[model samples]
Structure formats: C-alpha cells, structure tokens
Target: MSEIATSEAAHPAHLQHHFDSLQEQSQVASLGMWVFLVTEILFFGGMFTSYLVYRSTYPDAFAIASKHTVILIGAVNTAVLITSSLTMALAVFASSEGNRKSTVNFLTATWVLGFTFLVLKGIEYTIDFHEHLVPGAGFQMAGTNPGHAELFFSLYFIMTGIHALHMIIGLSVLLVILYMARRGDFSPEYHSPVEVMGLYWHFVDIIWIFLFPLLYLIDRHR
Candidate 1:
C-alpha cells in the first residue's frame, strides 16, 4: 500500500490530487465506468424487450422483415467489430505496459476496423432503403401479417438507428483519444481515460454480438 501511495505521490497533476492512491483512483474509475455500462445496457434493454414483445405478437411480420434483412452484411459487420475489439484490447494492453507506440498502432488499427464496420453498416442501410424496408417510406408491407406490419419497420429503424448513433459517438471518442495519444497525454501510470474508453468499446462490441444473432440470424420461423 505504501508503494502504491508513493506511486500516486509521484504521479502528475493531471490525475486527481484528492485520490490518496493510484490504485484507488483506478478502482474508482473502473467502477464508475462499469456503472455507466450498466446504464447503457438498460437503455438498450428496453428496445430489446420491445422487439421480443412485438416479435411474439407479430411473428409473421417479424419473419418477413428478417428475410429482407441482409444477414451476410450483418455477419461481415460482426467480424469487423470483433476484430476492432481485439485491437482495442491490445491498445489497452500496450498502454498498461508503457508501450505508447504500440498503443498508438493498435488504436489506429481499431479506428480502421471501426470505420470499416461503419461503412458496411452504411451500405446495408442503403440497401434496406432500396428494398423499401424502411417504415412509412415505401415499406413492402411484409405479407398479410396479422399484426401491424408498419410497427415492425418502425421498431427496426428505432433499434438500428440508435445503435448507429452509438457507433458515431464511439468513433468520436476514439478520435479524441487518438489526438491525445499523439500529444503524449497518456503514460503507463495514468491512462485511465484510455482504459475507460476501452471498456466502452468492448461493451459496444458485446451489444453488437447480441444484436447480430437477434436481429439478423434469427430463424424467425413463425
């Protein structure tokens, strides 16, 4: 504990001076970060539950909508995002070990993969638009489904649209982190910002993992 205190004392003013120890600081930061993640899960949970309820109520609509969805594109995006998560993990590892150069390289790789994912998502959205899958904008009216077919497209747009917004936010955060890294703002001792951001990145990846199977790969065998 004394060694930790000494390390904290020697650390820079950028870190909170109120914290008595670096370990405490890290623990608090991590806790706060995880709490934020929990809230994020809740935010998405509402939509997921709504999807389930609607799917059950309108199984035929759900199946037809699912058929129109590009599962292949979703699968490719999943691969892209998982690869980005791996690189983001490596970036955190590099930061922990004080290899600033490697950290930068890994972050760069992550950014590339993130952009790739976004591009593919954009293409998918465009295709959906062309296919008249969007609600109120030329919807195909998935068969004579018992329930409201329009509701299905509405839910689809709401869910996927919110997710895309999150991706944009993540990309912006990564850019800020990259700029700071270029400026030597982080070191092995006080890269809590990077660590927190990494946690967020991984959480987003996990969300997409769930989304892929539910939204794309589902048999929707109604």
Candidate 2:
C-alpha cells in the first residue's frame, strides 16, 4: 500500500489526505473499473448470444440479411471507434500528466470522433431503410427466404439499436466530462469522471467490435 501511494501521489493534492494513502484510491478506482466492465459484458453478452441463436436457426436468412448491410460502412465505423478509443486513453494519460491543455485537446478529439461514428451510423441506417432492410418499418424481402430474412433483420435492428442507445448515453456523459475538463476541474490527483468516462467509451467500442463481425462476417462462411 505504501508503494502504491508513493507511485500515484506526486504531491499532496493528488493524494486525498482523508484517504490515508494513494493505494486506497487506486484500489477503489480499479475496483470500480472492474465492476463497470462486468455490466458492459452483460449488456453486450445478451446481444451476442441472441444473435447466435437466430443465426443458428435461420442460417440462410442471416447470411442474406448480412449482405444487405453496408459492410464497408461498418468497417469504417469500426476504424473510427478504434481511433476514439486511442484518443480517450491519450486523454486519460494527459490527465495523469496534469497537462490540462493536452487533456482538453484529446477529449475534444475523442468527442468529435465519436460523433463522426454516429453520423456514419446514421448514413448506414439510411441506406438500410431505403433498401427495405430496416425491420418493422415496412421491411420486405422477396423470393427464396423472405420469412427468415425478416427474422435476421429483426435481430440486427434490435442489437444495433441497443448499441446506438449506449453510444448516445456515452456521448452525453463524455460531453459533461469535457465541460468539466474545460473548467480545469480535472487533474492528475482528481480525474475520476474522466477515468470513468474512458471506461464507458472503451466498452462501447468493444461492443461495436463484436457487432461488426457478427453482422458483417456471417457471409464469410459461405
């Protein structure tokens, strides 16, 4: 514990005097990070499991439906998400270094990248909608396996919908943290909000990572 304290606290302000040592703070932060990760896993886990069930049941429908999705768009979005994750980590690193300017720059970059991902997602959905790929919105498929196609698309929308909801919530939280960073509220000693937000942002990226392969990779088996 003393070792942990020595490593984390470069100054008194960084180590909460009330907490006895930096080790305690680090331990608490690590614990909280793990708990949050569990919830994230559970969230995406449900989606992944559901997708497998449907894919198993409607193999051909799943394959054909996947073709309708813009694989290139999904791939580009994945790359964008990866860049956001990088910026988020860099922002956290900036906070640790107490480089307020760098921290703000990184945060702003991350926020912009995240929004770009959303915009790309919107365009993808638009394409899906125009082609009648959207489920429950006058969705259609003709010949061969229209019934199974609907089932595949239904699962696609539900999973992606939940993921998009998470991204919006994450963006809101990130904006709040961004505001705080601008106010000079975060520092090496006090950056809980940024750290937590980083956890959330990373989790969202991971969810999309899975989503990309599941939705886009079904065709590879053929």
Candidate 3:
C-alpha cells in the first residue's frame, strides 16, 4: 500500500484528483468506455433488428438490392478497415511501450487507411447515385419489388451513413492523439487514451465486418 501510494504521488500529471492512482484512473476510463459502447451497441442493435425483420419479409428484394451494391468497393473498404484496426492496435502497443515515433507512425497509418475507406465509400456512393439507388423520386431498380428494394437501400444508407459519421469522428480523435504523441504526452505509465480509442476503432471495424456480407454479398452466387 505504501509503495502504490508513492507511485501514484509521483505521477500527478495524468492522474485525476478523484482517482487514487493512474491504474485506478485507467480502469475507470475503460469501464466508462465499455458502458458507452454498450449504449452504442443497443442503438445499433435496433437497426440490425429492423434489417433482419425486413430482409426476412422481402428476401428477393433485399437480394436484388444487395446485388446492386458495388461489391468490389465494399470488399476493398473492408480490407482497408481491417488493416486500420491492425495499425491502431500497433499504435496502442507502441504507446504502451513509450515509443513515440512508432506510435505516431502507426496512428498515421491507421488514419490514412481510415481516410481511404471513406474515400472509397464516397466513390461507391457516387456510383450508387448515378445508378439511381438513392431511394427517392429518381430511384430506379429493375425489379418487380422496387418498393422493398428502396427500403433496403434506405436502411443501407442510414446504417452506413451513421457508420461513416462515426469513422469521421474516430479520425478526428486519432488526429488529436497523434498530436499528443508528437508532443510526448503519452508514456509507458500513461497511455490510456490511446488504448481506449483503440477500443472504439476496433468496434467500428467490427461493425463493418458484419455489414459487408449483409449489404454486399447477399445472393451473389445467383
């Protein structure tokens, strides 16, 4: 107990007054992030449930709409996000080791990969718009069930649009973290921010992992 108290007293920089020690602070931060992510999961869960319900109701239409999605771009974006997750992990690891240079480099790589994903998605969205997939007066899909197909596209846009927003936010946070790393703000003893942001980034990547097959690979064998 004396040793722990001494260590905590030594590192007053990042330790909050409310927390007894940096370890305690980091644990609380992780718990808070988990709680926040749970709410996020529930929020997304509603959309996923809606998707399942509607997809079951209109399998044929959903399949047809899925086919219209740009699978190549979707696949490439998946790869990009998956790679970004790796880079993010490396960034966290580097921060934990107090390797400032590696931390910055890895975070930059993750940011670049994330930006690439959004850019590819932008291109995909453009193609979708040109193809009249945007569910409106100009919407067009060659099928007997254009109404249901539009519904599929509607969900697709909402889910992915919100996801893209999250990605943008994550990128912004990454920039902040990168700046901090450049300033030597993180160290082996104090890198919780990097670690916590890594969790958020991974969660975002996992969402895409589920989304790719559901939105782009449905009935592709046909």
Candidate 4:
C-alpha cells in the first residue's frame, strides 16, 4: 500500500497544483465544460423559443421567407460543418493516442473546414444583400404579409448571425490548440484541452444542424 501510494504521488508535469491526480483533473475539466454547455443551451434556448413563437404566429410568412433563403449554400455549409466535426473527433482520438502528427493534421483539417464554412456563409450573405433580403428598408417579399415576412428575416439574421459568431470563436480556439499541438504540448494522459475543444466544436456543429432545417428546409414542399 505504501509503494502504491508513493507511485501515485508522482504527478505528471501537466497536473495542476489544485489537482491531486490526472483523473481528478480531467473530471473537473469535463464537469466544468458540461456546466458551461448547459448555460449555452439555456442562452440559445431563449432565442429558440422566440423563433417558435414567431414561426407559429406567422407560419405562412415564415414559410415564404424560408423559400428565399439560399438552400444550396445552407446545404453545403451543413456538409462542411459535419465533416469538420468528424475531423475534430479524429483530432481528439489522435491526442489520446499520443500521436502529435495525426493530432495536428486533423486539427488543421477541422480549422480549414470551419473557415470554408464561414467563407461560404459570407457569400450567402452577399447574395442576400443583392436580393434585398436584409429585413429592413429595401426588404422585399411576394405573396405574403411583408411585416410578418420581415419578422422571419429578423429571426433568420439573428439566429444565423449568432451561430456564425460561435463558429468564429470555435475556429479561434482551434488555432490556439493547433499551435500548442505543434509544440508537443499534449500527451495521451494530458490531452483534456483537446477533448474539451472537441466538445465545443461538436456543440457548434449541432447548432448549425438545427439551424439548417429550420432556416432552409421549412418550405421545401412548396
């Protein structure tokens, strides 16, 4: 028992002063991340509820507005985000396996994919501007109540804009992780940062998953 205790006392360099063991540290980090995620869910939940109310109040207008959205761009961005999530998962796996090269490769791929999504989104926004879909003065829609249609556009801009902001933040975090990864800052036993970042990336991707169908596919049957 004394020998076991002595061996356990030898902490890894990555272990913080507040943590007694790697396991304890990992648990704390994971718990913190989950708590943060819960708060994020609540934050987004309010907007979602607002969306539901507005959508319900103006279903026809919402449907018409959704039809004007760039479905092709939304679909392509969805695919990009999903693929990025897969790469992020691979990055976490590589980190856990102590393969620095693989981790860096996968993280780079994820970052590139995220950047591509943003570029495509920017193009979509430019198209929206050209189409006069900006939801205020100069906004235009046909065969629906323009006021309700404007509301739909308002929600569209707010939801998707917030989502893009999260994507940018996620990409920035990935950049920091990539730099640290290149420096061999992580190991199989101390890759909690990578794991937590993966959680965040996945969460962002999931948000887009919801947004795609809501914002793009609501009027497909028409």
Candidate 5:
C-alpha cells in the first residue's frame, strides 16, 4: 500500500490518482468531452428537423421570410466565425507544442473574433426588431401568408438564439482557458483542455455555417 501510494505521488501534478498515466487521463477527458458534444448534437438536431419540416410545408413563406434576414451581416459573421475557428485551432496546436506565448496570442485572437461575431449578431437583431421582423403581435409582413412568415421568424429566433447562448458559454470557457494558459497551466504533455475546447469551438462554428445559408440565402436566385 505504501509503494502504490508513493508511486501515485511520484506522477505529475496534473495526473490524477485515478488515472494510471497522463495519456490515460487525456484519453478519458477527451472521451468525456465527446460524449457531452454528442448530447449537444442531438439537442440541435431536433431544431434542425423542425426547421426542415416547416420550410417544406411553407416553402414560399419561408423563402420570403428568409429574404428579410440581413444577408450581408450574416455573411460577415460567418467569416468572423471561420476566422475564429482558425485561431482556435492554432491555439490548440501552440499549446501542444509547449509554446505558451503563441498559445496565449492565438487564444486572444479567437476571443476577439468571437466577440466581433456576437456584436454583429446583435446589430442584426436590432435591425430586425426595428423592421418589425420579430415574430409577435407587432410582426409585419406584406404577403398572403403573413402567419406563415411569422412562423419562420419564430424558428429563426429560437434556433439562432440558442446558438448565441452556446457562443456565450463557449466564450466564458475560453476566458478561463486563456487565463490558465497565461499561468502556464498547459504543456506539450498535458493540453487536453485546449484540444477539447477546439472541438467545441469548431462545432459551434459549423452550426453557424449551416445556419447562414439556411436563414439568409433561401431561394435568393429567385
């Protein structure tokens, strides 16, 4: 019992006693994160399924409502998110290389880009509200299917609102990770947190990628 206890103590500070090795600890952490993300996927998947059903049922209304969306802002936000993903990926790479300075710099860039995306989204929402695009008693649309248009806007707000909430959570996590990086919490052998965060960031960005075209470019060629 003493030998076992001493052996555990001899391990690195980051390696928990429950984990036999650093590699094992990293694998466990990664598996846990993946499981959590899968649950998130199912949550988002239900919304997607609903969107498809409603769009198919009210194709014209959906298309017209989509046109009211601010395509320019949506496009710009997509670019910002894509850029942030790049920076996040670089941050993960830097952390795994034991380059603390580079990791902090990349993380900072990612956070800034993410903030820009949220700001643009806020402006877009403000424009929607001013234009009476929000689905409610004041919702206005000059079409035969105003009710259907309202439904489209309802889905729009629900889906994007949830996505924005996820972004807020992600930003909070990034802030903590950034502080940890500044304190030299990560090293080549122990960067699972960074890697796991990269997965989540990429997932959020991909969700937006799908949303941009669906909400802003529906039947635009018409």
Candidate 6:
C-alpha cells in the first residue's frame, strides 16, 4: 500500500537496508534472538540430562552434596538475579518509551545488580574451594559415597560455571547497551537491541530460577 511504502521510506536509522520497514526489522531481530535462545536451551539441556541421569543413579550422594552447598548464598544470588531481571525489563520499557535518562538509569541498575550476583557467586566459589568441593584432587566428601558425591560436585561446577560464563557475557552486553543508551542510540521507534538484550537477560534469570531449587534446595526438606 502507498501508506506503508511512505512509512518505509521514512525508515529509522536503526532499520537495516535489507529490511523494508522498522517493524519487519524488529520482527526479524526478535526471531533471530529466539533461534539463538533455542540453541542455548539445547546446550544447557544436554547438561541437565546428564544431571538427571546421575542424580537418579546416586540420589543419596547427590542429596548429601547438595546439603553442603551454601544455601544462604544461593538464595541471595537468586534474589539478586531476579531483581536484575526486573531492572532489565524496565530498561527495555524505558527505551520503548524514548525515555533516554530512564533507560540509562535502569540499565545501569541492572548492570550493578548483575555484578552483585557475580560477586556473591565468587564468594560461594571461594567457600566451595575451601571446603574441598571442587570435584577433583583435594575434593573431600565423607561417607561411603564419596565417588558419587564427586559426581554431584562435577555437575554442579559445570552447570554453575556455565551459568556464570553466561552472566559475564550478559554483563558485557549490558555495558555496550549502556554506552549506546547514554549516546541516545535507542528510541520509541528503534529499540531492538534493548529488547533482545532483555530477552537474553530474562532467559538467564529463568535458568537460575531452575538451578536454585535443584542445586541448593534438594536436601532442605529433609
């Protein structure tokens, strides 16, 4: 239609040349992000499957290992991540509303919270190291199931280590977004980057949601 054509002709700076309109560009970006997320899910899925297999085989050892985890630290990090997700959502919302200052503020808050989560995770890792829970030489778990307990720690490190890597990458992405936001790069008509980053952040947060209960709360009811 002529109206659509006219709108396309007024394309925002963010619109790529390959895309005919901003809406189309945004849709494509969203689809791409979703596809990437699917791959991420599959990647983590393999780890989760391994965990389930081992956990079923060694439920008692797994429970004992889980008991050794720092529950308070895990709980605190969960809260921190959840709060960061909220700030991320607000950042996306602010970008969509063309509120530059608000966008920067929210993104900065999200970044800080994310950093806090990582710091807490580092503290937990230090405790794990001192407790000899690192899944290799110097590893120490008592009782008759030390081997199975080692397996539990193995999976725990792989899972949480991968999650921490993701957090690091997410923090880097936030830095870029924050810089762009400060430069007034996003607007009501063009905020795909913010939106996609928000999606990634939320996905990471959801992973932690699953992880917290699995890794830290397994033996709590007992």
Error of 4 at 189 (Å): 0.8
Q: lDDT tens digits, residues 173-211, model 1?
A: 999998888777777777888899999999889888988
Model 2 stretches with alpha carbons more than 4 Å out: 1-18
lDDT of 5 by residue, 98-159 (tens): 99999999999999999999999999999999999998899999974999999999999999
**Steric collisions counted per model:** 0, 0, 0, 0, 0, 0
lDDT-better candidate, 1 vs 6? 6
Residue-level lDDT of model 4, residues 41-91, one tens digit each, is 888888889999999988998998899999999999999999999999999
Prediction 6 TM-score vs. true: 0.94
TM-score of 3: 0.94
In order, what lDDT does every prediction score? 0.83, 0.84, 0.92, 0.91, 0.92, 0.92
TM-score per candidate, chains pooled: 0.90, 0.88, 0.94, 0.95, 0.95, 0.94
lDDT (Cα, tens digit) per residue for candidate 6, span 1-222:
223345754765567677887889998999999999999999998988999999999888898889999999999999999999999999999999999999999999999999999999999999999999997789998874889999989999999999999999999989999999999999898999999999999999988998899888977776
Give the clashing residue pairs of candidate 2, or none.
none
How much lDDT does candidate 5 score?
A: 0.92
Model 5 bad stretches (over 4 Å): 1-10
Error of 6 at 131 (Å): 0.9
Candidate 6 regions exceeding 4 Å error are 1-9
Deviation of model 2 at 37, angstroms: 2.5
